[model samples]
Target: MVDRLEQSKALASQARLSVLGWLADPQAHFAHQVTGPPAEIGVCVTLLAARLEMAQPTVSRHLEVLRRAGFVTVRRIGKWAYFQRNEAALADYKAWINDHL
Candidate 1:
């Protein structure tokens, strides 16, 4: 389960919000991946790093924050890890926002 405060903190970061926005429309934001489908398996950390023009480790840390916040889900294919939006969680978060603030 995700803590509401942690999730709110995750949403406060521009980098992390950018990640979520991109993942929300992976096909348009990201190039077609060879390892797996962008929507199905999500975009690779390396690809996200390149797109964000940031270091892989930095992107990974951002992803870790989002993952812990329940805004994204990660799947490992061999050595590569792909990240996709957790749509249900996102909807729930949105509803929570509506109800709270």
Candidate 2:
């Protein structure tokens, strides 16, 4: 598990926060994917890149930070990597915020 400071650093970026917000309601934010259900398997990186209007590599770099910080979880399907918010980690972060600041 990542420390709170690490997670905090990951969220410092607006793009990363946007990714988390979108994943919070994947079905509404992202288009239905042929790879799998958005809510179940998570949203594809391609969709995220398109939605963010950024290059895939750039979006991927943001996602990698979140992944390392445990703010999001990834599921690999063939060549694609899907992502969703780590709700448990999020709850812990929220609780920490409520307790500390």
Query: Which model scores highest in lDDT?
Result: 2
Separate clash counts for every candidate: 0, 0
What is each predicted model's overall lDDT from 0 to 1?
A: 0.90, 0.91
Off by over 4 Å in 2: none
lDDT (Cα) of model 1: 0.90
Q: Distance from true position, residue 52, model 2, in Å? A: 0.4
* lDDT, model 1, position 94: 91
Estimate TM-scores for all models.
0.94, 0.94
lDDT of 2: 0.91
* Candidate 1 error regions (>4 Å): none
Give per-residue CA lDDT, model 1, range 1-101, as digits (tens).
65999999999988898999999889898756777679878999999999889999999999999999999999998999999999999999999999998
Question: Lowest summed-lDDT stretch of 10 residues in model 2?
Answer: 28-37
